[model samples]
Target: MATLGFIGSGNIGTNIARLAVAAGIDVVLSNSRGPETLAATVAELGERARAATPEEAARAGDWVVVSIPLAAYEQLPVAALAGKVVLDTINYYPYRDGRVEALDTGKSTTSELVQEHLAGAKLVKAFNNISDFHIPSLARPAGAADRTALPIAGDDPRASADAADLISRLGFDTVDAGPLTESWRFEPDTDPYAMPYSAEPDAMRAFWAAAGEAIRSGTAPQTPPHVDQGVPLTAARLRTLLADTPRKLTADRLVA
Candidate 1:
């Protein structure tokens, strides 16, 4: 019933747009390359989808998803996104994003930086941990046995709740992982980063904890494990994993 606008229509953006359309949400897609480059994606999403400039998409969306590289956060249209609910799906990779002193020094998290740029917008961090390739298969209708859960972090309670509802409509439950500062828990290489989980919350939690332990100990399984991609997990498991996970210094995390 709502229109979802995307500032970056790459792998994660396009896949999320597909899910939004499947949920009966219209989508306006945009990218730095120009609206023309999004023709195929808009067509694939059918009548409910259209292509537009980043600013246009920002103005058109009920909720705007900013999935662009972390380095490009400053380029987002600030005025157009004013007072909008923004879903931030950015991750920092020094090699890819070059060096961002704020991120490198742990002065602020990635979502915090985006929030600073779009000062009037309500920013929520989510969908960054999962791989685009696993999204479709991992989704399940509400109450389905195989439904999965995703984590979201934000400073605004209302905005966070709205984001959780949207995530549910997209076929996954939401776990409030505190404020944006805590988002690093689900960032790259963390326990809950890209690990798949079961429809059951408990199972999903367990999977997160196990995965976290494995990663810290250097025993995490390679992608495409013997089993299928979406692994089952529980909340209790995730808590345990988070407890066991050692907090790395910002300097150490930035090295790679």
Candidate 2:
């Protein structure tokens, strides 16, 4: 009877909640907009989920996931999350999050900034690389040969192991990508970003082409499609993709 809490009930947050509940974990979801706004989502998740204020969600979790915009990191409830293992599914997008000087000069990885703001929390960078649409579609039963392995990076080994276990229970394997500093490897525009788990390169490209256009034109759909279960990525393959690759930043990484 474990409970997972969320600080943002947007794309990534809801998807992870769905997976967690499906795995028998209860979820407490909150957003910047407030709990009442999440009524429909709570109903959709059934009895295993409920909506609360951000502070309540922060304090309620056995382990919490913070999937908010990176710009809002410092706004998180620091006291509530002080000693918790916080999973960060946040990435830096200049256009969406504005410019961050430390990131601009390569002095900080996104999670490091999050960790610094949360102080005593054990933070792990995770669930950030994959597209939210592909999340549920890609999840497979444990021990399934084709189960995809997501990458996680943390400064603490024990916390990383706990996070890895969380990912496994939600139906994915995990590959350790060293410390938080190395998290940049799987960010947007990198080899392992969201493309590999997309199942088919063409479908991923087509959906993004249409979706990105819609977003830019101010009409993006609420749910992304073409992901009827992506390719099952193995640990070996993911390891190869995680090799010593340099970061590649571009405006194309803007994912709103």
Best by TM-score: 2
What lDDT score belongs to each candidate, Candidate 1 first?
0.80, 0.87
C-alpha-based local distance difference test score of model 1? 0.80
Q: After best superposition, candidate 2 residue 36: deviation in angstroms?
A: 0.6
- Model 2: residues >4 Å from true position, as ranges? 206-225, 249-256
For model 1, residues 96-213, the per-residue Cα lDDT tens digits are 5777788778788888888988899999998897767667768878888756677789999999999989988987877788888877777765767665342343444455456545
* Ten residues in sequence with the least summed lDDT for candidate 2: 247-256
The global Cα lDDT (0 to 1) of model 2 is 0.87
TM-score of 2: 0.91
Q: After superposition, how far is residue 63 of candidate 2 from its true place, in Å?
A: 0.6
